[model samples]
Target: MPIDMSVWQGRSDPEDGNKGLRWHQKVQPADNANESGIMLLGFACDEGVSRNKGRTGAYDAPVAIRRALANLAWHHEAPVYDGGNISCDDSNLELAQYRLAEDVSRALRQRHKVIVFGGGHEVAWGSFQGIGNYLVQKQHVAGNANEAQQPPRVGIINFDAHFDLRNPPGGKQSEKGSSGTPFHQAARFCELHNWPFKYVCLGLARTSNTQALYEKADRLGVLYKDDHELVHHKMEQTLTELQRFIDQCDYLYLTIDLDVFPASVAPGVSAPAARGVPFDIVEMLLEPILKARTPKGEPKILVADLAEYNPRFDIDNQTARLAARLAWTIARAIR
Candidate 1:
C-alpha cells in the first residue's frame, strides 16, 4: 500500500516556461497535513473482478493509470498529492477495502479533494464507506449545537454499463462481495443507518443487466438513463435532471466505470460495452456536477473515483489515457 515513487516520474522541461508544467512536476506525496488540495489514492485490487468471473488484471490498474497521468499537462491551481495505493493482497478483498475506507476518511477529514483510481467497480464500496465515516465524524464534531440539523444527504452518480447490484453467487454470509455488488452494498448501508439511497445511473445497457437487477433498481428507487437516451439531442434534458439530483443533495459521489464507453474507446475494462455512450457526452454530463456548489458556496462533490480499468486488455494504452484524461478534467474542474 506504499506509494510507488517511480510511477510519478516523467519528462521534465525547464526551458518551456509554463507550458512545461505536468502532473509529475506538480504531484507531491500526501504526507504533509498542513497542505490541503487534491489527494490521489489508488485501490489496488482485482479480487472482486475475479470473484465475479471477470478478467483478473485490474489489480494493476493503479500503476497503469498513474503512468498515463504522470505526463499530462497540469492546469489546476491547487496542490496535488499522491496518497499511494491501497492494495488487496493475499486475496483478502474485504481487508483491502477496509484499509481504503480508512485512508479515504483520513484524507477527507484533512480537507483534501480525493480521486481514487480503481482495481474494479468494487472500489465504490470502500469510497462510499469513507465518505460516510467522514460525514459522521464531522457531525459529531459539530456537537449538539443544532439537534434539529439533519444528516447530510449524499447522492451517488454512477456512469456504468451494468447495474452492478448483484448479490454474491451465494448469500452474503456464504460469500464475500464482488465487483458487481458495490451499489447494492451501499444501499444496504444506507438502509441500516436510515438514510436515503439517492443513486443515479447513466449509460445502462439493457443487454448487460438481468431482469432481477432491473427489479432491484426499481425497488431501490434508482434513477437511470439507458445508452440510447444519452444522445446529443437528449443531453439537455439529461443535464437538467442531473442538476435536479445535485440540488437535492448536500454531497455528491461520482464514480465512472470505464466500461460505460464503447469498446473501441475503452477496450481495457473487464466488460466492455457493446454499444456505449460517447466520451464527449459523458464529459458533458460531468461538467455541471463538477462545478456544482451549495448555496453556502461549498463544493457539493465530496469524493470521486474512476473504476474498472484493466490494463491487460487495453489497446495501445487507450483506456489508461482516457482514464488519465478524465482524472485531469476532474482535477481542473473541481473547486
Candidate 2:
C-alpha cells in the first residue's frame, strides 16, 4: 500500500514560474491537526471490467490520474495524503475490494476528506461501503438520531454513461459483482444495513444501456436523467432537481465515471460516450453540491471517487488530464 512516488515530477521554476511548482510539490501526508485534510486512495483493480465484458486497462488509472494532477497548481491549503493503493489480482479481487473499504473507513475516522481514484466503476461499491460505515458509526455515537428522529440519509450522485445497475452475474449462484453491478450491489448493501438507497444518476446514454437495465433501474427506484435531457436550457432544472435530492440526505457520495464525457474528451475509458455531457455542464451540477453543508454545517460530500479512466486508449493524455482537473476541482472546493 505505497503510492509510486515516481509520478510526482513536473515543471518547477519558482522565479519565472507560470509553469511553476505543481501538486506533487505541495501534497503531503494528511497528518495536520489545525487544518482539514484530503486523502488520495488509489484503487488499482480492473477484474470487474472483465466480468462486465468491457475493455481492460482501467487498472492503470490511479497512477495516470495522479501523474496528471501532479502538474496542477496547488490552490488549497489542506494537507493531502497518499493512501497508496489497493491492487487486485484475478484471484483476489474480493479481498482487494474489502481492504479498500477498511482503508476508506479509517480515513473517514481520521477526519480526512476521502477522494478515491479508481480502476473501474466497481470502485463505487467499496467507496460506498466505507462512507456508509462511517455514517453508521457517527449515528451510533450521537445516540442513533440526528435531531430528525431518524438516522441520517445518505445519497449517491453518479455521473456516468450507464446506470451500472446490472444484477449479480447469473442471478444467484455466481454472486460475484462487476463494474456494471456496483450500484446494484450498493443498493443491496444499503438494504442490509437498513440504510435508504437514494441514488441519483446523471449523464446516462440511452444507447449505451439496454431495456433490461432501464427496467432494473426503475425497480430499484433510481432517479436518473438521460444524456439528451442535459441541454443548455435544462441545466438549471437539473441543478434544481439535484438540490432537491441533496436536501434529503445527511451525507452524500459523488462518483464520476470518465466515460460520461464525449469520446473526444475522454476516449480512454472502458466505454466511451458517443455524445456525452460536456465537462462544464458536469461542473455546474457538481460545484454547488461540493460546496453544500449538512444541517450541522459539515461538508455533505463525505467521500467521492473518479472511475473509468483508461490510460491505454487515451490520445495525448486527454482523458487523464480531464480526470485530474476534476480531482483538482474537488480538492480545492472541499474545506
Candidate 3:
C-alpha cells in the first residue's frame, strides 16, 4: 500500500486556504498607510497532552481556525497581519509560548488589534506575561514610575467550561501549564502585578469544581456569572456592564474557551458545553467590545486569543467557523 500525503497538505501551507477561501496576505503584523485596526494571531494550546485523552486534534486548532477566519473576508477593511500559529512542540513549551507572546507584544507595540487562534487555554499564562511586560516597559519610557504598577490596565472576560480556580489539587503551589489550571495561574500573575482586573466569567454552569474552588473564588473576589443567570437577565444590559468594566482598564484581553458554545454549535472545543451561549446571545454580549472602534493616540491594546479548538470532535467545522467569525466581530469593533 502507498502512503497518503494529503493529510499533511495543510501543514506545509497553513495560511494558504481558510474554509476553502484564499487570503491575500497572511504575514507578520504590519503597519501601513491604510491603517488597519487589529492583528490576527493563531496557536495550538499546550505542548504534550495526548489528543484523544484531552480534546481530539486540538493541536491542529490554529490551522483550521485560521482557515475558517480567512474564509470570511468580511472584515477586509481591518488591517490584519496573520502572525501565524505558535510552535507548540512539547519539548520547550514555555519558550515556544513565550516566543509567540513576544510576537503578540510586538503587535501591541505597533498598536495592532489582536485575535489569536489557539492550542489550549494554558497559553494565557505566557500571553498575559507578554502583555504585562509591554505595559511596564512603555510606562517606564513615559516616565510614569509611580504609576507603572497600574500602567498596564487589563481586564478578564471568559466563556469557559470550568472556573479553573483550583488551588493545587495536591497542595503543590505551581505546576507546568495544564488545561485545568491556566485561569488560576493567570489570576495569580495579574493580582501580583496589580493590573486592573474586572474578571467576569460567563457560561460556566457545568464543572466538577470542588468546595476548595469556591473558597478560593471567595477569597479572591472573582466575579463569575453562570449560564442560568445569563439566561434570565437582559444579555445586552449585562454586556453593557461588562463593557464598562473593560473600559476601566488600560489594556483589554479576552479568552474564549471553545467549550462555551454548545456541543451542537462548537463541537470542536476541548470540552463541548452541553448548554452553551447561543449565537445571538454571544453576539449581543460581545457587541460593546466589538463596536469599541478605538483609533490612534488611544491606549494600545493587548490582543485577544481564542483557544482550545479540537477539530477531531467537530461537526463539519461548524464550531471552527463560528469561533473565527466571532474573532472577526471583535476585531472590527475593537478600539
Best by TM-score: 1
Residue range 1-335, candidate 2, lDDT tens digits: 44567777787868946346579887764443345589999999899898888999999999999999998887776788787888897547677778888889999998889999999998998998888777778778786544555756888999999999888877823447889988887888787777788999999999989999899889878889998898889988888888989988888899999998999999999998999999888988897789889778888988989999999999999999999999999988876
lDDT per residue as tens, model 3, 122-153: 66666776676777678777765464344455
Give the whole-model CA lDDT for all candidates, comma-separated: 0.90, 0.86, 0.64
Residue clash pairs of candidate 1: none
Tell me, by lDDT, which candidate is best. 1
Residue 236, candidate 1: C-alpha displacement in angstroms: 1.8
Which ten residues in a row are the worst by lDDT in model 3? 1-10
Q: How close is candidate 1 to the true structure, as a TM-score?
A: 0.96
Better of 2 and 3 by lDDT: 2
Residue range with the least summed lDDT across 10 consecutive positions in model 2: 27-36
Question: Ten consecutive residues with minimal summed lDDT in candidate 1?
Answer: 167-176
Which residue segments of model 3 deviate by more than 4 Å?
A: 1-37, 48-53, 144-151, 168-175, 232-237, 292-301
